[model samples]
Target chain A: MASPIQENLVSKNAEYASKFTKGDLALPPAKHYLVLTCMDARIDPAAAFGIDLGDAHVIRNAGGSARDALRSIIISQQLLGTKEIILIKHTGCGMLTFSNEDAHGLVKKNLGPSAAAEIATLDFLPIKNLDDAVKGDVEYLKRSAAVPEDVIISGWVYEVETGKVRRIV
Target chain B: MASPIQENLVSKNAEYASKFTKGDLALPPAKHYLVLTCMDARIDPAAAFGIDLGDAHVIRNAGGSARDALRSIIISQQLLGTKEIILIKHTGCGMLTFSNEDAHGLVKKNLGPSAAAEIATLDFLPIKNLDDAVKGDVEYLKRSAAVPEDVIISGWVYEVETGKVRRIV
Candidate 1:
């Protein structure tokens, strides 16, 4: 039996597929750019950032950490020809709420020692300041050897409270 | 001066924020689940997967690689209370088009030897078979010490040609 969420997926997907017509969209993003943003439940990158169905790649993760996203970013650029990256972090992010040690301790408490050992050395990439995080990710991408020098890179903070995105770097 | 893409973001974000009202949602996803999907341009997790604002976390990376998204997944479950994982990869993904060696060669040619050397040991996590890839990721999550055994994990393939999602595991 499917979970309730999975059942929701089936019915909603059926609804979406019934009217879908952009089946012929190409593998490469049509506008040759990508958006890297937080996986925050409240932020919808396509709606807020004005991305059409086939316009750009949307890469989301916890905190929208650029270091964590470097692998995906490289593949998006090298293999698929994306030339621009818009990296957006956000205000009131969970990354700003805890430290790596806190995460380790939580795993130990929540899932016991085995889980703790599995992630003992992992860095959760927590953020100290929202503006600095955005600036830092943009700078990291700019200096990354894997990222081409000429590729356009910018950073922003998405305001979950207001749904506004302001440029940060 | 901002890039054209950045300009688009500013204008579009203004439009979104002008009508925004859902500012009271909590930090943790209300539905306590996450959707891990490909960063492919054609896939919109919100509309296709039936996720409302503040409903679930959405983590996207190249090919929706489970390994690539491990950290974010850990954070989502351990800290944010997500109990289910819906991992979805899609047909016509760019990841289906290249091997790790092919990616390396493209990097070497496009961004020089230094760029290639930086990612020399990095696995791009390319997928060869769609169904096996979905099943493999679901199995990986099931067996991983970091992911609790009680977490409900399922895998699916989103067909870009038809916008339909079918379960694989």
Candidate 2:
């Protein structure tokens, strides 16, 4: 059963399509950079980060996990010619609300024992300190085998409350 | 030194923050769904998909690769409470432009031998066909033990030229 919001997506998209004009952008991003950020609904990467049409690749995940995003990051840089990266985690992220044990318990309680066992080895990538996580993700990218040494990678924290970004590294 | 556009990011972000609102939404998405789509700047997932504040988690990557997004998908559904998935790929994506070998050669040519050696085994997750790719990703998510069987996963192809999405699975 499609939800009302899902149905709205189709109709609203049609309206957007009627007025859309920036559909002829190039394959590779014009600015030749990429950003790894969270899938937080509070943030709009395009508007908040000032990324124009066909400007950059934005790889977003749960915690903005660098490890989770590395595969796409490699492809973005190697295949698409992006030379820089901006990794942005945010304040008040749900990833900060729980530990691995907490996540496991939630899975077991909500999904069942089989589902819990299925994800037993999974890392939720939870972080205790926001600043440390940002700096660590930047450092991880710097040391990554897949990321070239010359590719400039910086880290920042996007404050969902204030809609401001604070550079952490 | 930040690029000219990177500098624009700071200035633009400041402008956005000055008028920011709607930062008090709940932790869980209001609509309890997620959209796994491409990082292509041409597509604005929020506006195109009619995702309002705190509506859904939008997981984006190169080619909108579901394999790359699996970790976050698990977290979004299990840890968070999203019950549905919208897997949307687009036409004429950069992922369709190159194969793994082409990416490897570009890595070597652009970043030298050592960098090429680092990502020698990378799977760029390139798609040869758009509709088939969307179906395949939906199937992949359905087959994954991590994704619950009851979770409604649908596939669509977002046409960059026409700005319309066609259902594939």
Candidate 3:
């Protein structure tokens, strides 16, 4: 049986597909850039970031961890032609609330020891100071040999409390 | 000096944060579920799928690949408390337009031989057939022992053409 959410997705998508006309946008984003943001439900990247239909790639992950998102970032830049990156981590981020140990312990608590064992090497990428974290991610990208030095990289803190984004680096 | 995009982000975010007041919502998503979708600018996951603030975590990647999103999904389910997964891959996704070879070649062309060597092992997670890809991701999640057996996993196609989402599994 399809869940209510799934059913709603179908109907809502039907309504949306009916009027959609931009079926010809190129595979690579036209703007030649990408934004890495948290998957926070409160922030709408398209509306908030002024990204158009074929503007830029938006990569979201928990805490918007640049390290965790590096795989996708490489694909976006190296394979897809994006030349710039805007990494955004937000305030009140769940990542700000836990440490690696807390996350590992929680995994054991919620999914049992085997689950914990499975993710024994996992880096939860928790945040201590949001500003430092954002700056650090930009530095990580800059220092990364895989990421070309020519690629423009900057980091920001998107405040969930007020919806304001402040550039950190 | 901040770039124009960075300045715009700050300004636009200020406009949004001024009216934003959903700061008191619970930390753990209310419905204990998460939606994985593409970060296509055209699709608004919150408005399109009826996902209210704090309802569910939204994990997005290039193709909404379950394999790529597994880390966040684990965190959402095991650490946060989400018990269900709604994985939605969209029509006309960039993932559908390339193969691993093409991706590797693009990387070599765009970022040079060193970059190509860096990502020689990357999967790129391209999609040959969208339907099969969606179904395969659901199966991947179901078979993963790290993901609890009881977790509700389903896949769907979010048609960017008309904005309709149809369940595949």
Candidate 4:
């Protein structure tokens, strides 16, 4: 039996595909930029950030961690020609509510010691301050040699409370 | 002075926030699911996958790589109560067009030796066969100790040309 989510995806995608066009868009983003944001459900990068289809790449992960996004960002910039990055972390993020130890403990409790051991060395990249987290990510990208010096990178805080995004750095 | 992207984000966000209302959604995804998809510019997870705000966590990386997404997935499933994972890769994915060495070479060419050294050992997680990639991600999650045995996992492919998704595993 297909799950409800799976069913919904099929039906919704059918609707979207029926109206789909622009199948000839190129591999590289048309606008030469990417947005790195959290995977938080509340923030839809395309609608919330004004990105149109084929315009930009969107790299999202927990806390919108730039460190975790390094590989993708490098590919986006070096190979595919994205020249700018807009990295946005958000308010009331799950990352802000826990520490690495807390995450380790949760895995230990939920999936046992083997699972805990699997993630023992992992850094959850939790943040205590939203503004500082955004600024820190911007600085990390700026200083990283993998990220070219000329690529414009800015950071922002998305207010999940209000569907608004404010620049942080 | 704001860049065009920055200025556009501020103005566009103001329009979104002007009518924003769902401020009471909880941190845990309301539907207890997460969608892992590529950061491809043409794929919009929310619109394409039928995810509503607060419905599910959406994790995107270069290839919708389960390995790259492991930490975030663990946090989502273990700490935040997401019970299902839908991992989706896509047609015309940038990952489909390169090897790890190709990525490394590009980094060296574009950002020089120091930048290359920084990501010398990094795996860009490029995909060779799209079906195998999706199946591999599904199998990886299914077998991972960090992802609980009871968690439902499925894989799919999003056709950039058609705006359609078809099940893979």
Candidate 5:
């Protein structure tokens, strides 16, 4: 038996799925480059970078941390056939707002104490420095056995107010 | 010394970063949610799902396949403290166009035979069925030891033509 919320979601999904024919939405070859960045409201990859719809693969996350977007990067490059990767971390990012302690407290309050404690132990959370964070992420990518050595990997910081991207390392 | 291409990118990124104040960005909590979906021009998660800035993290990939977005997911949830996850695979996805053999051949011709072979072995590429793909991604989220059991995992297929999201079990 499904909850009321789940039931409602199912009905809505079915209705949405009915509107499209299989032929209309065909996938394209995995050519071009891949970009990993933040999902902040102010940053627009298309306008800022002049990226068209079919040109590159974009993966956005909080803080634009490369570590956070690594899994997607592997799949995009190893599986999807992309050769170039651009990682864009941004200024005024929501990620730089909280500390590990604050996050642990929030998680404990919203989830549970145990869950919060578990999160604090992970090496990937609560980035202390922005420049170091970007450098660390680039290093991680470079060291990853899955990522090809020839794949061009670059890092940048996007300024939300100016709509520009600045390469950091 | 940076190359001409690297120098150009750095300038663009710095231009954007200059617009933000030190206080504009908020740091994330210990636990956050990272969402991976398609960049279908039609799906507006902000309007439809009511996701606001500084809310759940969003990572947009080509087809929302776990395999393609796996590295991102791992970093977001594991390092960023995201506990809940939503994987949105949409209807009329471009991923449905090429078969495994075709994708391999294209990569071989454009990139190299070894690169193509690498692509063929990845679990996330060349989705066979949309429904199955959604189910498989959810299952991967649930079964992965890296992901917590309590993580509220859901999968949906968004219809590009109708702008509706269909929940897939």
Candidate 6:
């Protein structure tokens, strides 16, 4: 006997799986380009880059910090066979609002002191300028990770107000 | 004297930063939910979960596998002060198209024999069933690394065909 939650889950899964016929499935490209960007509503990668649905792998996080996106970067390159990486940090990011002290206080208030302490020790790469931040992130990916030397790593800044992307480095 | 690349980067950064005033900044929140999903074009968490920008930290990857997004997840939780984690894997993923053998062959052919050898050792968790996969990933997150036990971890499967999400235990 299935619980109500389990039954609901099965129904939902069945509906989602219905679109695909097993015979119609095709493998994705071996070499993929992974883009690490911010989840800001203003920065639209598809429109700016003229990217289609299946063209590039986009990994988005807060502030579009490459340090935050490093794990996915490794997996995308090593396990998923992506060669190129593009770090797209944008202007008007919410990350620039708070200091490390504010972050610690918030964690302690909501999650308790123990979790807050753990958070304090974590490294956060701050951005003074969006273009420099994007470039630095690209450099970090190239140098810190196991990405191939020939990998075309690039950095770009998406202007939130103007809806333009300028390749930084 | 700055290189051409550095000069271009500096000018672009200055141009973008000029649009923002000091008042546009928002204070950091008391708690953050770090979410990991896939780069599948069909899945949209904001519409499904009613989460706005700056509400939760979302990290996306190719398979929506936790291992692939582990680095971003760590940074979001540890550095950015997110207390809870929600790992979402969706149905009808492109990742399920290729078997491990096929992936190995493709990487070998394109990248090189050594690259293929390295990729073969990588643990790319493939899921035939979406619900089971979500639950399994949640369990994996609990066991692996420095993830907090009391972090209120949960897993959900987003059905691409129907824009609906089913919470999996």
Cα lDDT of model 4 by residue, B73-114, tens digit: 998987789999999999998898989988899888877899
Model 6 lDDT tens row, A47-76: 444443444567786678776665456556
> Ten consecutive residues with minimal summed lDDT in candidate 5 chain B?
B22-31
- Give the lowest summed-lDDT range of ten residues in model 6 chain A: A22-31
lDDT of each: 0.92, 0.84, 0.80, 0.90, 0.61, 0.61
Q: What is the lDDT of residue B51 in candidate 3?
A: 77
TM-score of each: 0.98, 0.93, 0.91, 0.98, 0.59, 0.60
After superposition, candidate 5 runs with Cα above 4 Å error: A1-31, A99-102, A113-121, B1-35, B38-57, B61-87, B91-129, B132-155, B159-169
Q: How many clashes in each candidate? A: 0, 0, 8, 0, 30, 0
Q: Report lDDT (Cα) of residue B110, candidate 1.
A: 86
Candidate 1: tens digits of C-alpha lDDT, residues A63-101: 999999998999989888899999999889999999998
- Give the poorly placed runs of model 6, Cα more than 4 Å off: A1-31, B1-35, B41-57, B62-87, B92-130, B136-154, B159-165
True contacts kept of each: 0.85, 0.68, 0.57, 0.84, 0.19, 0.12
Per-residue error at A129 for model 6, in Å? 2.5
lDDT value, residue A16 of candidate 4: 81
Give DockQ per model, in order.
Answer: 0.86, 0.64, 0.55, 0.84, 0.19, 0.15
lDDT of 3 by residue, A6-117 (tens): 6666676666566777766766778888899887666667666766677788888888888777777877876678888999888887888878898888878877887788
Which ranges in model 1 have alpha carbons more than 4 Å from their true place? none
Candidate 4 lDDT over A1-169, as tens digits, reads 8998889889988988898886888889999999999999888888889998999999989999999999999889888899999999999999988898888888888789898888789999999998998888899999999988889999898999989888888
Categorize the docking of model 5: incorrect
Mind giving the per-residue lDDT tens digits that candidate 2 earns over B26-141? 77888899999998767788878878878899899888999888768878987778999989999888888878788777778876788777767777788898888988899888
C-alpha displacement of A86 in model 2, angstroms? Answer: 1.5
| TM-score comparison, 5 vs 6, better candidate | 6
